[model samples]
Target chain A: MGGDFGPQVVVPAAVEAAREGIAIALVGDEAVVNAELAGCDAEGLDIRVVHASQVVEMDDKPADALRRKKDSSIQVACRLVKDGEAHGVVSAGNSGATVACGMFVLGRIKGVQRPALAGILPTEKNPVVLIDVGANVDSKPQHLFQFGLMADVFARDVLGLDKPSVGILSIGEEEGKGNAAVREAFDLLKKSQLRFIGNVEGRDIFTGEVDIVVCDGFVGNVALKLSEGLATSLGRILKDELKSSWLSKLGTLLSMRAFKRFRKVTDYAEYGGAPLLGLKDIVLVAHGKSNQLAMVNCIRMAATSVRNRAHEHLVEKLADHQGLNGKSEKSAA
Target chain B: MGGDFGPQVVVPAAVEAAREGIAIALVGDEAVVNAELAGCDAEGLDIRVVHASQVVEMDDKPADALRRKKDSSIQVACRLVKDGEAHGVVSAGNSGATVACGMFVLGRIKGVQRPALAGILPTEKNPVVLIDVGANVDSKPQHLFQFGLMADVFARDVLGLDKPSVGILSIGEEEGKGNAAVREAFDLLKKSQLRFIGNVEGRDIFTGEVDIVVCDGFVGNVALKLSEGLATSLGRILKDELKSSWLSKLGTLLSMRAFKRFRKVTDYAEYGGAPLLGLKDIVLVAHGKSNQLAMVNCIRMAATSVRNRAHEHLVEKLADHQGLNGKSEKSAA
Candidate 1:
């Protein structure tokens, strides 16, 4: 019901994941879903076609669609979770609309300030989780601190890290080196129970020095997209250089296989969807250009979250740490 | 006086630039500057040394250093500009301290709210300018607008553009799609005489769609360093993948010269220093790791800015468009 391909690519991927024993509720136009499903061999699989009358276009305003399009695919998907008919909802449509629906329909966890998107990137050492990549643009210090707390649970439970270390994304590696929000958030994290490392510079994000990097949505989104842009620009520049010379043309021909391996390490699409943390239920937002493989991977990742009870752990973590027990600042690196 | 090599590298570069017809005033400890100056044949060049009693370490706070280190090299360099003994000042020292010294020593230009750093980056098509990169972290709306105002003058003067289009850095390209500060800044830019191109996403920074990208120092710094980190990581990944196979070994060997060209397009040091804008006089802040060539390039860049009278043009533009003469929002891409 979302993304560029809409039901065309999603139907088959949902059927495939359903075949893999993950129950997938396909929410979109009933006619469109059934028509796409007819092409796939989804007989006897745990796949249900939930009729969503309206579709949220990518350009639709989030608040506008949330207020008017009650039966929109994204809204209907979230309603499935709210009504206890589904464990979670996955949408590739309007991310803003999806976030709105998740917040308005599923509601946030107790004491959670804001539900944020945890973007996962393949780094040099390990995959780093960047919280609030594009959700909740104007964040407060408390919201940023909550981003770290929620991302910590997701990283530990879903990513299988026993005790993930966290750092605030800032301009420098010093204690007092960021904007007002980051400075305040640093104070909050330093007083928490998380494995809080001191400040980390922007370059430290992909180096995987820490498992989790926390920042407001604006900076996180910029970091995510800037890294993607740089990688793309680098590839284009490398290819142009390699093709300009006859010797390099031969080099390119010989190194074709290695180029594929390089793409695997740099491509963010190789990973599944980014999880929308701080929500009562597990909702993952796949990339807008997600293909069948990506959809299947995202569905598989969501199933892992559900099986591991990541949301419950997040809720418990919130309840257990209602008040800052370790409010004494700890200077760490 | 600054950077890793300090006077050792600065002396030879200053001598070379001075020989090339740019006057150089080497400011640092008299004995250390003389010892380094003795290494180079700078007798006929217009290279003079000024004695400075103290040096500002990288770890020293900007405010503390500004208030205490009276004769620091950076302060002395800025003082030379203020006293009209030098046209411009260039330092590869602590950037925060440099900005602080530039603000207090040289004083802010008339009608300028905050002084900022304009970082130049080489994109696929042309070099792009990112303003307020780690200069002032918490920027107000009017300040972001002023950054665009000042950087527009810089792109036209130093970068040599007729009409450089400006865009506010945001999570999306639509109007009113960013955080609170960006949304307000968008409104301010739209009302100005500059060619405001609505909002630009993070990945668009390298695509060269717009000439100037304006944002606060926090997000701008993240974008700058994240791109550098990704480029470095990509190089390492490509080398590892290419060397793992004998076929790619041949490819890597043949494409060595082309790789040098790739480095030139991506290496930020090739562009030399970033200019700290909105000051009464020209002040360029070079990278801390600037070598001899980088120092010379930075000095040359400063000279270019000085010769073009970028500061005066900025002041003029600030006057001609003081009030919002064009406040009507013209929708643009």
Candidate 2:
């Protein structure tokens, strides 16, 4: 309801998910959702409609909305997770609101210092998971270390990476390169048991140098958005340039097979959506302007996460790591 | 010479730059440079050879190189500019070494807080100038404001944008939605005479919302590199996808014109090279794997910067803005 094309794009996607034998609970204004689903056949689909009295505006502060708007759709969906009524929650609304609701309603897992938003980006080699992509903007080195640990567990349980190599994004590939936060994080990450691949440059993110790339929310958000913008602008430019001249047009014809492959590689929609990791329950946040196909994909991703028990796995791993560190200190003393 | 493709790609570029009537100074080992340029026609080309004793390894610490290797190629090239023997210096060598040598030799202009590396990104509307792309990792709010001032002047004098709108890169576009550093910088930039566009999100950087984008070196470097990686990966994927199937091949044939247009739009070669802004003399840094055409274009960009006196114009603008701010504060008091 908050996106530029929220209810419109989301309605058909929900219907499709029901037809495909996936259980879905549509949390929104009861009247509006029912109106949109009036003509669609929701047969044999475990479709439940939850009524919410309010909506969170995109411009509203997330913390304030969580505190004040008690009956909001996002808050209601999150509450279901808190009460074990729902396995996971999916939304295409305000990102901050969703994150805030998740943190407040579900609360952080024990031993998890901070929650980080993990975004799965489509790279040339498999998919790269970027954590802290706008969750904790002002994070300490310990928070970054925790983010790396949580992401490592999620990737192993969900993405099926045996031992994900972690990389700290920096200006250069050297150890002593970035700002104060990154430099300090590098020192900590290097000493950890995780497979730290030393420091990685921005260009290395897409090259698959590491499975998990960690940074503060501010830098991660910037890097993610910039990559999207460049892909978009480049796609538009390629379309324009291909039509400019006849020779280029013929060359493009000869190279058509290669071009389709290129399109799939750059397509973000195919990747489904980004998961807000460190949340107590599974919550997938799709792009606001997502079409029916993107929404369907997000649903599939959510189902996969729920089936894999990603959150439980993450919590267990974090606890074990913490326990090991504490035991080592006692022995040393 | 330390890049993936060394003399094979760089030698031809030097020859091409010389042929384009740009005074070329090849600053590497004399034997290697001469051997590479030996086969090419040297007629009517003002090409000179400057010999340097050392080459800064890419893996070497930037500060250590600056402090220890005083007679390196990067240092010698920058020295030529300091002594007025050359109008500009172009290198495809170590970026940190280049920045270090340039700062130590050419020196910063008066009242300039820090020198930033600004990359002109090809966006949706027009080219957007992103500054502080890896000069100062840890920066104060004052440094960011100066970066905005410098980027604005560069856009006006170099890129030919009239009253270029400047934006501070942050997680959110709202005024109060950033870290302590960004918040302080936002306040400072709002008070400056530059055309401040408040705060901009990561996605907006490529949307062409503002002509100039400013951030700390850590964030800027990550943004710039991530964009590069995405572009490269996208191009590779499109080529692979187009060749995947026969039907997609036909679609590629139909869309060949569009594909070429897309390539042209994403082509960094068209943009020539990124100017190392805030240096006393014009300095253009080419990518290590830059082709001959790219090197020639870099020379063209450097010549334009020199002809327009971009650095001098920027210094003047900074002084004027500082004076204006001082007077406004005095009047208020």
Candidate 3:
């Protein structure tokens, strides 16, 4: 689909996925896609290049792009999901555009008020799933509950956790501390049937106390970006420190094995991609500046999602829960 | 004055400040402070210990502490400011308690409705100030506007910027993006006298496009903590990466000088401490786990705040602006 480097990275990644027994429908400009794939061999694989004239720029307004450029790559990819032509859509492009396209074309799941972007963050213990990372800006208590449910389902199915505990991000771990929205969400979460672990502070995000952390897009996005910036800045700092003296360089050499293990744990690329939850079809959004290895890992992740039928499982669980809740309400009445 | 590892770190830091010709007033358990200073030389230095029995734990209710524990270190320190006994109060204690203590004891500056905790984050280009980090959770548009003004004053007086550019943290750079509070804040910021740089995304916080970034406490706290966690994790990861193989170790040795430069840039200790802005007195809050060096640096930062007369400058500017605005309103009527 549409991305920063668009067809160049997309074509090769698509070919690699196709070769690995995964059907890939590349949605972009036909000429551009073909030009990218001109030198590559996609033999004995189901690979199709869908025509999309318009390309959504990273700077373009999501609503404007969706409204004005209906035939954009993101829109076309979303249309494939709507028409049941593809099992999922993948993009490394404008996050807002992807979310807008998904909502507009695929539509939200029944009983799910707002869709959230779930980002997998590497923690000391395990990868923590953070939901609502810039998908919906203004979220209600009900929306937060739905987001928690959806994230729980995703973590259980994809992350292979038996019962993933969810925590609502707040200023304090206490029962009645936070803004109006967080307080309301906390109340709703406490009353829910899900495995809710109450409130978690900002410092607890990396401690891995809860598998799933639910927050509004504004808070989640800030957390996610701040983490990224800090990681980048720290990496730069550590590299500088190792070169300070000859003795430190020797110490670094002696502790090389330990450092490698640490690198493996902190590498964001190892997580592959973030899943756009509450969509009809699976959509994995890789980092825009992702290299070849990250792209390959993303394709592999996409294949896993499709094979597991993650979206269908989420839909079924959400439907069953809603049905049971409705029946309970009626009985109580 | 107040913190997790209270008298131990605070006393030594205060002694160091006194040695450096900065007046030191230790507002905590006098016995504990004297015991910690028994082995160290306190010659020809103005170091006085004020007794305060109450201590605020990390999990304690801030408002409750302010109401009940009137003689707590944080409260007493703030009272010193109210009574004109001290120019500034520094603490590494519970942030909530500090904020509450400041509000109740020191009171807000004229024309400032709410105070904010301004955390200085080290970025690639320069250090950026994040306002309202874990202070007032539920913030209104007017509160955010006041936070921007306070941050601007801080950058000018403390950070030494002539006209610091302020940015409202949003999902996108566009004016119409973000939630209700941010949207309202954006409008107010645009109309204000400060240098408003429009909306900035979460990713832009580290890019250093603006000197001061304004947000509600929830988002700001999450951003600050996430950045801290990410930096620590990334530093560990890079140390491991450099030891992966012999070639990598060699490369690390060759690039030792560059690596040290990088670490210096990302070192939080180098920044000293963060100021709690919008209060009548100068108050600096250091990290909870700050060592003796960090504490000493915090004292140095407090001296800087006192020397710059940050509190007096802020109060004068705010009162003058309020007076001018009031006159304009009367004339318009």
Where does model 1 exceed 4 Å of error? A325-333, B325-333
lDDT of 1 by residue, A157-186 (tens): 888999999999999888988988789888
Clashes of each: 1, 29, 12
Between candidates 2 and 3, the one scoring higher on lDDT is 2
Off by over 4 Å in 2: A1-12, A15-23, A241-261, A323-333, B1-24, B35-38, B244-260, B323-333
Best by TM-score: 1
Worst 10 residues of 1 chain B by lDDT: B324-333
Clashing pairs for model 1 are A2-A93
DockQ of 2: 0.50
Candidate 2 CAPRI category: medium
The residue-level lDDT of candidate 2 at B237 comes to: 76
Q: Candidate 2 residues B1-333, lDDT tens each?
A: 534455566667767777767777778778987887787777668888898888888777778889898878888888888888888887777777777787878988877768888887777778888888888877777777788888887888778888999899998877898877788778778888888989988878887778999998889888888887777778777766776777667657777667655665566666766777877787777777666677677777887788788888987887777854354333323
- Model 2, A1-333: lDDT tens per residue? 555577676777888977877788888899988887776776667888899999999888998889999999999989987888788887888889988898888888777767888888877787898988888877777677778888898788778899999998888877777877778777767778889998888989998667999999989988888787777677667756775777657656766656556666667777667788877788888877677788888887787788888878887777657854343333323
Provide chain B TM-scores across all predictions. Answer: 0.94, 0.90, 0.89
**Superposing every Cα of model 3 onto the true structure, what RMSD results?**
4.1
Report, in order, each candidate's fnat.
0.78, 0.78, 0.44
TM-score of each: 0.95, 0.89, 0.89
